[model samples]
Target: MNQILPLELPNGISLEIKREDLLHPFISGNKFRKLKYNLLQAKSEGLETVLTFGGAYSNHISAVAYAGKEQGFKTIGVIRGDELGDKITENPTLKFAQDCGMQFEFVSREAYRLKTEPDFIAKLKDKFGSFYLVPEGGTNEYAIKGCEEILTDKDANFDFVCCAVGTGGTISGIINSALPHQKVLGFPALKGDFLKDEIRKFATNQNWELVTDYHFGGYGKVNEELVQFINQFYQQTQIPLDPIYTGKMVFGVIDLIQKNWFLDNAKILMIHTGGLQGIQGMNTILKSKNKTLIEVQ
Candidate 1:
């Protein structure tokens, strides 16, 4: 559902958020869209196990764990940071995945860097039996195919579509389905130019551009200001945005509006690709450092 934000903006600019977060309790937002067909294909191939990769607090990991279990497939998560293996109980995301019966293979950060290598994957297959592989962030062709369904006819009226970019999958799908006159703006959570090439590999349209200024340092890095903004936004809108993606994108959109970057009377639709599951983990970190926490109800 598209929810109109009650913010008063200059230039008659209108804002609405596509609450993809409400799609499911666990497999919500783009995660649901990205995994829809991939899981089906796995089942079609008579696969009984699904293996994927992520970090300690990855939303993809959490979603895949619950979704795989719900779909009657055993799940394995190849996690970065070998140290996290022993810290599972203290980490909400890892603990939740474990509770969902997702087995984990913790690898060193250096070894995790070889995740895309064929030799590394061959070693994994040698260690574990044959299983369906869902790449990190779930951005394979099948995943993108699923993400393309995010925008429907009801969204056609918007002048611009906005979303947070991670692995470039969600934005690529939005770019594919967007109208010719509508522009798609992607706010990448990480600081890098490589995402453009990643998006190009899947996106067939030229209507989208990346707004790279709002990462607030890099992936998984947040400050008090961002925490405050997220808290305030939720208090006002009653919409909880995960700090990693949607929060940053919404901050960027509102900042751009204040700067008068968009034309007058433009209507913007933002995709709330859910990562709310990570909030508990993030809040745990914030508390350790005595930083402002993201408010949740």
Candidate 2:
């Protein structure tokens, strides 16, 4: 866990971040937690292949590829945007996945939206044969089970447990394991209250809620201000944060602190769910748009 030093609030609020991002160099953070049992289950089921879905620069796509390689399972990534099929070299995430031996099945955005539909899944099964399926963002019962282990008994001392919400898996797991007195605050990477419903499906505890004010537009969207904040934050703490998830959560948490959202002397624990690998891909987009790039190490 890394203690945040720059956030000097008036109410004596202290923030400690769990560096789940440091859990692995590639499959880090919630991805690491989410994939643990799913991979084990695949092995136990005698599955020789793992298949999942994601977008162009999806951390899930990249992590699943690496995890599959490490576990000796053939992996296939059903990537959204068929146009991306011809642009693999330009995308860091896809290129890394390819190097890790993950095959890609690029589909239209419309088709990708039907990923949960039986017909679409049947088509994939027909093409890939029998494979262990992991949903986009790696959220499932096993994923949630793995995530529930994120918070340890030692974390019971904190009054608030905060994390970036994506696909609702990580926070759901945190919500399930959090101490009764610890309120789990989720800062969503995407724009919507729909996440609350999704989170409720897995997180049985009522101690968690979403703070939805800092998306910077929506998923995979960013502006100059957010870019500057992420870069400056890296400079200040020597910690690299991915703009899509952790950066937004940290920004919101500090903003909330400035607004005196928590009581005096509250201890907040932020889960640094890693998406750092996506920075290179995001920087590529930022550079083309003539925007400030994420300062990656």
Candidate 3:
């Protein structure tokens, strides 16, 4: 559903949000889109186990765990940071995945970097037997195919479509399906220009660009200012945003609007890619540092 924000803006600009977050209670947003075809292919191939990778509070990990269980596939999460293995009880995301029957193989950061290496995958297959692999962040050809369905003919009137970028799959899908007149803006949660090439590998059009100024440090890093903004946004809109992704994108879009970066009378659509499940884990970190918490019911 698309809901227009009632905020007053300069130049008669209008802002509306696509609530992809409400797609599911667990496998919500882009995760749902990315996994839809992947799970189907896995089942068609007669694979009973699905293996994927992520960090401690990765939305991909949480979603894959629940979706796999719900679909009758055994899940294995190759998680970064070996120390997190024993800390599952203290981590909301990991605990939830465990509760959903997702087994974990925790590795060090250095070893985790080799996640895409052929030798590493060969070792995994040797140990765990045959299983369908879903890359980290769930970005693959099949995932992009799923993400391409996010936009519809009803979205053609919008001048700009904005979304948070992680693995570049979702934005690639958006870029592929966007109308030629509409520009797709991706606010990456991570800091870097490398994502451009990643997006280019899949995106067939040149209607998109990444706004890199609003990462708030980098992926998974948030401060008091961002926390305050998230709390304020939620209090006003009654829409919860996860600090890692959508919150940062929304903050950047509004900040750009305040700076009059958009043309007069421009209509903007923001995609809520859904990472609300990470809030509890983030609040745990924030409380440890005596920082303000995001108010989400």
The estimated TM-scores of all candidates read 0.99, 0.98, 0.99
**Judged by lDDT against the true structure, how good is candidate 2?**
0.91
Candidate 1 lDDT tens digits, 211-283: 9999999999898889999999998899999999999999999999999999999999999999999899999
List candidate 3 segments past 4 Å from native: none
Stretches of candidate 1 exceeding 4 Å from the true structure:
none
Between candidates 2 and 3, name the one with more favorable TM-score: 3
How much does candidate 3 score in TM-score? 0.99
lDDT of candidate 3 over 40-130, digit per residue (tens):
9999999999999999999999999999889999999999999997899999999999999999999999999999999999999999999
lDDT (Cα, tens digit) per residue for candidate 2, span 1-297: 666667556777888888999999899899999999999999999999999999999999999999999989999999999999999998999999999999999999989999999999899899889999999999999999999999997788899998998899999999999889889999999888899899999999999888999998999999888888888988888888899999999899888888888899999888899999989989989889888888869
Candidate 2 ranges beyond 4 A from true positions: 4-6
* Residue 119 miss distance in model 3 (angstroms): 0.8
Output the worst ten-in-a-row residue range by lDDT, candidate 2.
1-10
In angstroms, the error of model 3 at 112 is: 0.6
